[model samples]
Target: MPGHGSNTESMETASAIVSLITASVAIWKTIDAAICSIKNAPARIQHWRAINRLLQTSLSRMEETMKRRKGAGLSISERKHYESIREHLQCFKDDLEDLQHKIASVALPRRFGKRTIPRQVLTALEIKLQEDPHLEKRVDRNIQLFQLSVALLSLLDPAPRTSVRPILTELHALHLQVSDDDDKLRKWKESAHDIAKDAAMREIGFTSSATDRVRVGRQPSINIQPTPQRDFGIDENFNKEELLHKIKVTQDLATRLEEAGMPTIASNFQLDAIKCGEQLREMHDHPLDMAEYVSLEERYILILISCQSYEEASFQIALNRLNDLASKVDDTSRNELFRERQTIGTLYAKLQDINSAIHFLRIALFDGYLKQQDLLAYDAEIRQTSRLLYEVYECSGMWPDLEVTKKRVRDEFGEDPVASSVEISKALGWCEKKGFTVSERDRQLYFNPLTNENGRTSLHEAALDPKMDMDVLRYLMLPEYYSLRDDSGDTALLLAADRSNYNVVEMLLTIPYLVHVRDRIRRQTPLHRCKDKRTLDLLIEAATRRNSIPPGTDWEPVDINSADCSQRTALHLACQQGRVDLVETLVAHNANVNATCLTGETPLVLACWAADTAKPALEAIVRELVSHGATWEQKFPVRRDPRKRLKARGFSNSDISELTRQPGSSTESSEVEKDASILMHLDS
Candidate 1:
């Protein structure tokens, strides 16, 4: 039994030994796993540190390069350097991605139950990256990326308290740098704006010169300085006082001399009066009322005597002076002074100083002191004055001033002053009115006021009379009245042309705005109205003055080829007038010598029908017309009766064939001949 018991115990001890060895092997594996996990922690941390270092270096280089780029002007070489740096940063980014992939692929420690790397290790890497100067410089930009994996890991594991504070501190530092840089950049931009504005102001001719000061946001200032006074034979201040005293003494002596009426002293008085008058005349010329009333009276007296001079120019000067003095006088004194002023003005008008006459008359007309009856009593005188003024205005071509005087007279008198007349000899021995007249003399209208019908004034019968005075027409052509059309829709230009008044036509055509005016028909232009050669020549002169003409106007002569109502051109009329020279002139102007009348008759046909005595003229015109491409059919052939048809010429077959070929004519040759014959008879 003991032996058996020994065997059982030996077996049990062996089994126990086997179980202990197995437990020993299992513990060895557990220690090995714990050691392996601990060993991988530092290695993994080192890899994270390397990644952090790489990221920090890359970001720092990028930030530094950007700052350098902003502060310094970059050359091509520097830009190339930056490109290389950007490539390096991209490589760094790849490296980081690779590191992340590698870290993600790492097997979690078995003891940690499939969790990733510890949050503490990731936090350590992020905190180290934040402390790195490179990453610190761009913390705000890099922080989110830096913390991405780490923060995710932290959700799985607790984050390190030490790492969080440092990350926030680094982030704050980066924000402050970005803000400071932004503020500096903003200030620089503001300064640049101010500089640009100032440069713009300087370029626009706004300069700072004393004489031409540029006052911004203020009223313009003017600099005024007193004229320097010169001493005349006395101390400066003392001379002024002494001069005043002497003037007072002279005045007292003059008064005594005037009251005593002494013969010996009278010469001194006269001499003093002459001196005062001369000074007064000087004042009148300048029209300075700064002098006292006594000085003005002396000036008026001087003006009166000067006006009395027989010299035309001297009298004009004196008359102007009197007018100026009258303008300065008060209303109460105007009527009392009217006679003297009127005398001066009337003399001025006689001297051809119409400007002065008009000036004085305007004042008198508007003056309240003059009664309407008194003005009416002087109506003849006023009309005479206006006539003289109109004559002067006509001569001087001062239409604007003339219009002003006319308007003033119309406003005050409600009538044209030039139209009034005085009775002359009675008609046939009957009484007639005396005024400016348009009369006929030597087969031409003359502007002699002494004649019968020719002496009619323009205003008296301008609208009613057909024959106008040449001078009156010239006056009407003045700018003030050039646009005035008479009752017949005839302006001064048209009237002058109709009258064959060459001088009047010449004057009318000189007006700038009258050149293109058409008559009531809207067809007869001023150029179209001329009838006589002299009048036509005047039109040519006016047209040449400004070189103004329609695109194809022919000024060689009155183009009788020019057509009017009834298709009668100037050439047709010239032919009818038997004006052969005028016809030649018209032909030279490229006038359509073949131009047809409404009935299709040419100027040649008209001349042919007019008279056999005009046969030579008719032949010349026909030859010119044919040379200018006039159709032969425009003339007629001999008729059957030969005498009766001589007056009513017939057409030939050749003429019929030519007429058949003309535009819009497709009839048979016999029908064309019949039509041509009909047209010819209608023209005749």
Candidate 2:
């Protein structure tokens, strides 16, 4: 009877094993089919890998469980428990397969009318898939499977399943989600119980009182204070006084922080100051007395100026508010309005809004409240405003406006104004004639503003000249003067790069400050203006020399990756101008190969854009950038169209396929061939 029973048990075990293997194979085939369906999608690749890892783990566990149970002659209860665990595993497999199908469906492209689903839909799907909601469900299923295995093992064996304990512990640790309120309650209870115990011990031998019974069963009492109310108008009056005081304190603090080079912290304080100023205005029902109005304008102007560095948008908004306030002022306060308009014009000029700059400057110049007697007293204002007007007029080639501005200058100041002021004479190049002593000429030009209409200081004129005066450059090469910009906002270094003055550029290299100074027009560093390889080499060498500080020093290195207003780095400019040597030089100096411009053009994209015209040189540049790890990811917006941006400043429908074409493939070459054909047509 015992031999017969053993044979039956062996036969039953083999049959069960065969059934489990058949089910396992079916589950795997389902998973594989699901994976194959989604394999075409780049976004679904990670999900497939995750699912693979999960199934791989489940297969390993199932195989191990079967191996352990193979020779073991399980009783009826143990066999039933084993079957239950196997059934749970089968359920987990089905759910996992279902999840794979759901994910695969997400990867399948959707068609709406003639056009496919928009990229935004694909992006949303990618994000949704990446979040892996199904993975959490898989983990939960894992926990259930682990629990079932544990329960089955406990029924079959007397010892704990030590192998899975670590996994279970890890899962528990990962999934533990305690609330902040729960944590606080736990801490409070411990503290309260300790205090109650201490009180009971202290009163052990004393007579028990109603309040001294420890009160361990009752909740701790907390007293809440009632806030006293004041009259609305009086409260507002108090707040108005307090708000002004707060604004002053906050402004001072922000200034101190900014001076300490903590601009981010200073911005926080500035926001608070502006908030207080707004509240003060609100307290008076938004209608200010003349004195309060003037004070508020002054406060907002200071806020606008102080916040200009890091909060430019806020500063622009503040300028708008100040302009609105100025319009409300009567003619008696017209002088204040004029000053406000002048401030706005100056800010607009600094921000490179030339049209607005011209508009407000003209208003500040021609329409102030100064009477004929007081006009001479405001002579400095008239000259300064007229000078700015003349500069802009010259830059924009407004010849009629230039003549009008020249007349305005002579009418406002005196005729021969350049000769009357020694500083102005030197700034206008009047002192550059053969007779003046070098020291005297330098001194005269020292305090002159580079934007002065009178021909700017000889430094700017010499810097732009192809055959530059080396002696004059060395004489005026003081560090303080190196960053001075002309009317067009081109510094001496920028002028050299603009005109490709290699010799003048070499002279300016000794002063490190000149190399990093950005011109106000485009906020471009000198390196940004380099259109040739030789000039770029000179600038790079200068930058390296400047940055080669000894270890442990407090000097900041030159930012080779520093971007202009358009966010084009030095590398972007070098590649755009088709200087391969400069591109390689910039890359060697650690310029980001993947640095993008405002229009999402990488050095590679820019290089590729010109592949039709300058194929060999640009192809070499493209190859160099790729080897340096340049990617095709567009980091900035070019347009609403999904097509890649071209160098021609226009989009072509065929360019999209060309951009997305596989690099080094015949398709890529064909696109370039087509591009060449298109170019020929356009040129003709």
Q: Output the number of the TM-score-best candidate.
A: 2
Q: Which stretches of candidate 1 lie over 4 Å from their true place?
A: 1-474, 478-480, 512-529, 541-562, 627-629, 633-684
Residue-by-residue lDDT tens digits, candidate 2, 147-265: 33432242233232222222222222223322225432233223322322222222331223222122232211111132445556434455666766877886776566544333334
RMSD score of candidate 2 (Å): 23.1
- Which stretches of candidate 2 lie above 4 Å from their native place? 1-43, 46-241, 256-268, 278-323, 329-336, 351-356, 369-376, 412-421, 424-525, 528-684
- Deviation in Å, model 1, residue 415 alpha carbon: 26
Model 2, residue 374: what's the lDDT? 77
Candidate 1 lDDT, tens digit per residue, 48-80? 332332333323333432432232222222222
- Weakest 10 consecutive residues of candidate 2 by summed lDDT: 217-226
Q: Model 1 residue 340 lDDT?
A: 44
